[model samples]
Target chain A: MNDVIICRCEGVRLSEIEQAIREGASAVPGVKKRTRAGMGPCQGRVCQRVVLQLLQQPPSEAGESPDALQRSRSPVRPTLLGDL
Target chain B: MNDACDVAVVGAGPAGLVAAIEAARAGLSVTVVDEFPWPGGRLLGQLYTDPRSHGRWDGRKISRQLAQEAGELGVRILGGATVWAVGRDLSLELSGVPVGTLRPQALLLATGAAERALPVPGWTKPGVVCVGAAQTFTNVHHVAIGRRVLVAGIDPLALSVAMEMHHAGVDVAGVVLPPVSTTSGALASPERAVARLADVADLAPNGLLRAAARLAAGKLSPLAVSALRFDLVRVGGVSIGFRTALVAVEGDGRVESATLRSVAPDGTLVGPERRIEVDAVCISAGLYPLTDLAEIAGCPMVEVEELGGLVPLHGPGLETPLERLFVAGNLTGIEGAKVAIAQGRQAGCSIARSLGRATLVSPEDAARAVSDARTSSPFRFQPRIAAGRAAMAELWQQAIARGDQSA
Candidate 1:
């Protein structure tokens, strides 16, 4: 489970997220900042829900489910800069 | 395609297609956009018997019917078009189509639900896929996941897809529970998993058991679980393993075998790990509403546990807090395709009414259709869907009272 890949895009492992949580990174963004789990191209679509569940685990630091992970920025899908 | 239209629906699923049909029939120029290369969304691979009608609900047939009707109504459906963002002014930024942006008088977001992932050890292996993807590949694309496949996760979708794969000539090794973790909660417990199976017992592929299950009628009597112990329930030759947990799927490059362990009824891992030789692993964690577009549209969302997670708040009429912005289908909450189609009709009429256009059917009638469909659907993804909808309606009233609907 420790070696299991949590974020496929960033290759973030389960151990990395556990480490992030242990270091006071309660919310998804905190974990993203520390371990870059959701910063990848798919933009956390695949992994944020798992991270949210991890936060609500026993010894939870999430408190109250941490406000729906930040609203996704523009270009939700991969788009070329040239298109702009 | 025209850069603008009377209505622009963000998904081409059952809900979006139905909404487009209604709006277009009302003489509104409608365009429906979908990210998939085809019009039908998740409605593609569904195949189940409606206990009420004793008839089959073939997803592929229904999707084609809806798409054909929409086309006849002059609704332009752009497949492979993704709406990347919705600007504050409600202008849609799109890709994979000739038109880069579309400005519409009204926008309906029927963005359907996405399957929840259950991450197991060695899940990233090549042959591991979500249960929904397995269903699609087998039923729609006519592709086999593997000759011998083991499924992890005992839910309605997983059970149904396992049966579907068996029908498609795949050796479905076994349908087992995912390992219990902080997230898996009741899913890992044999009793709880059996109770959930009892809910959809009518859909059992076995004729004798299906009749017995129908007699039980969605009741959770202890006798039901005891009579059909998970190990004893053979869903069309596919073994159901409630006490067994699929801990991992390991292979060199693709799936070659899976590791299973015994799970006690009290939800503890006991005994030694057992290895099962299988070529593929399909995991079904569950499903949640796909709400990215709703959030991007600036629609206020509320997390209703009954509705299967965060959904855009909307009234019974399917009108959201944003003016001229509407939502339907799984985007509002997780329900069957029938409920989604009904919600689409309601949203279409509501959109037409909002624009001061006469609709073929009144929004009130359409809303009744939504409720009727919800009540009659055999599959209950979320049992408390009605309660979830009522909560959402209450929240919508609160939002309206707070003057949030003017946007």
Candidate 2:
């Protein structure tokens, strides 16, 4: 197993995310708040694919089709803070 | 205090900033409302560390300067105020509550753009993130997200984040795309981008070496690998884990884990479910115009196939169907900052002229200048943007379906 960085803005690696999962971050937003992954400049535009790949399959059934999940709020690209 | 202005600009990005500045300079009592504590909109505090050199700048500084000049011209700037809804009468709701209405002689919608969400299996996972979010965290708060990160998409914003992460001492794994080159226009020519990357490598040998090293190191750490059980493949020194066995993405609002049926390339269900752990995930699918306010204000909008959804169909004057309501910036389309500024300035001049303000430059002259300015902007990524929108629609549909099934 190699360390995979899923979100570049927050510097979150797959390993650390899995660790967070092991440590009981049961949901995406939960892990995000704890690790600060999707909370960066481009929002979550960079590491989303990796997150989906890593979090594939729950503990029970492997063949269960992955369900599509939606973000509670849409992420917008960061503008100049002053401009906002 | 109940005050009147010749022009009321909503938002303070390049569009609103320029609008207020130009209009006030033209002797209009301009008032600009922004949701942030200061001006600059998304450009301020958005971190973009130079990929070739980890250089930083406070985006707010530029906006501050513009604000200063506008202030000197007597433009009323209202920061820390949210314009929730804009009405046809040019009345604005502040923070979902009713505020005093300002029926300015003219109004400009510089509402900018918002990020488009693309749904994917496990996209709701805990570590999944957005490119804009990551930039905000790093640039605004001076916080680092994670040690290793993976960027998706190929937009300049996506590349900028990867470069920023690398410069911020974060290990950027690699950028992933949906088996297609979405960006195909002036945004960045594929050949030119590759050449620029080469230039970046030449300029920042260390960044290039680190990117090379990360690419070469196939697979993530054993802990992440074992926990996630992702199928890994090495490509050009980068370890790419393809989740072929994705069945369904599940989470309680926030993403916890996804269900995999079979790995891709060949669809075969992997028996027994396994969870891949991650801290954050960033998604940069595409961008959409923030046209809600424009729509509310009764602007004559048309769906531009090449420019994503609902863009204002303004003629040379930047005037909407509403005589006093003008639209500019990304609210019309996802053009670059320079174009947005130019459009805003032109709109300001047009509004000023309509108010009979005599100036050295005529509205036609300003329009010509705006047209010239727009010609040089590097925002011709219509194809890629369309693809990104399509992808986002797919994701949204999938999510809705999943939500219905779960319910």
Candidate 3:
């Protein structure tokens, strides 16, 4: 899982997110700023929730509350200026 | 350009197209809007052969026919226009680029459903994608998602996608389904949960899969004997939908393998977890209604467990509480395209009647269309969805009553 890349856009791995959490990135945005997981073309549609889990729990525990997962973000579609 | 039209329908999918066509037939100036360049929502990406009609009712063909009919009716299509906001006055805010204020006398929000991904440990890997995304990349873009793939989940969508991938020469190792007992947060009450389970059971591929498996084992029934005598690959390939549950996916860099376990009907894990190596993993857990536009337009919505999520509350006529505002298709529920089309036609005719046109879709035609949709589609979840929707509508009324007392 450490070698496996979770954020395809940022090229970030699971370990990097965990390391950022270990280094005091306790929230989704904090991990995004610390580890570059959500700063991608997709704008974190894919990785932010996974980042949240890594931020909230230690790696070995491997547990995150699906029921307690945060709400889906707004403006569902990605907006590129040129496309607009 | 004129700022007002007889009707402006947002979304150009199956539901939207049908609504626009029906509205035009009623002698209305109809405008159909969508964010995509194409008209069909899920239809263009679907390629499943109808099991009942022996491959006659093609997905792509039906979608093409709807788009063509809409065009022939002089329906205007506005592609790539994203709706930013909609006022009570029916004034729409475009994405800061399209120069138009759509002030239609009637508005139909046919905005369709989107994929609902259930979380898995390795779901975020590079090669992991929703099954709909796989279908879109292959059918629409002429791009192969992966050379070898493992699809996870059960439903017509999963099997249809696996079949499509197999047709495209991708090695679809197998499709995996979770245990029937595995429920989503969408199911709230026990009664609704049990009803949805029955609906899933009625549509489950076990009978077909078992029949195919017996054919594989050389104990084929007379009807199955012919299917085996003709082609064993198709039967065997589709039969994989049974006998598996996805526990987790183990991967490195990209999707390297998916961990699966066999499960029984009683929700008991039957075998040791096994990992099958594959380049990609696609999950078709199911879809929830896409209701952002309906929400932004301020339509009252309630969580219908059977329909999969919170959906706009509407009367049987598909008219929202908002005046002259209507909704159809998956925006109301997750009942597939056939039902969506029927609801669209119903909404269109309802809108036309409100506008004082009498003969757009006759009463008999409207009844027939809805009846056909409820029973004709390959997938059958109408009973569960109908009950859930009715309960939601009742809940809405109770809330309104409470609000009135409070005010």
lDDT tens per residue, model 2, B1-407: 24466898988998899888888878889988887777888777444333334554346666778788888999888887666556666765554112345568888888887765544555545666778778777666667666556655444466556666666776666554322111111222222223223322322223332342333232332123233344444433443333322233345655444343333222223457554432344656556677656765655445444455446545456666566778787776675565677777888887888788865667777766665654443333343443433443443345446542121
Model 1 CA lDDT for position B269: 85
TM-scores, all candidates, are 0.93, 0.60, 0.73
Per-residue CA lDDT of model 1 for B1-407, tens digit only, reads 43888999999999999999999888899989999998889889887777788798888899999999999999999998888889776778888788888899999999888888777888888999999899889988999999999988876778778878888899999988886766566668766776666666755533433533443344334345444433435544777776788888889998999999878766678789989999999998888888888888888777777887778888878888888999999888888888998988988898888878899897678878888997787767886787888888777777779888885
The regions of model 3 sitting more than 4 angstroms off are A1-76, A80-84, B51-55, B179-235, B238-243, B262-272, B363-368, B381-383, B392-407
Clashing pairs in 3: none
Candidate 3 on B47-79: residue-level lDDT in tens?
544545555445577777888898898888887
The fnat score for candidate 1 comes to 0.42
Give DockQ for candidates 1 onward, in order. Answer: 0.45, 0.04, 0.08
Query: Residue B349 CA error for candidate 2 (Å)?
Result: 0.5
For the record, the alpha-carbon RMSD of candidate 1 to the native fold, in angstroms, is 2.8
Q: Categorize the docking of model 1.
A: acceptable
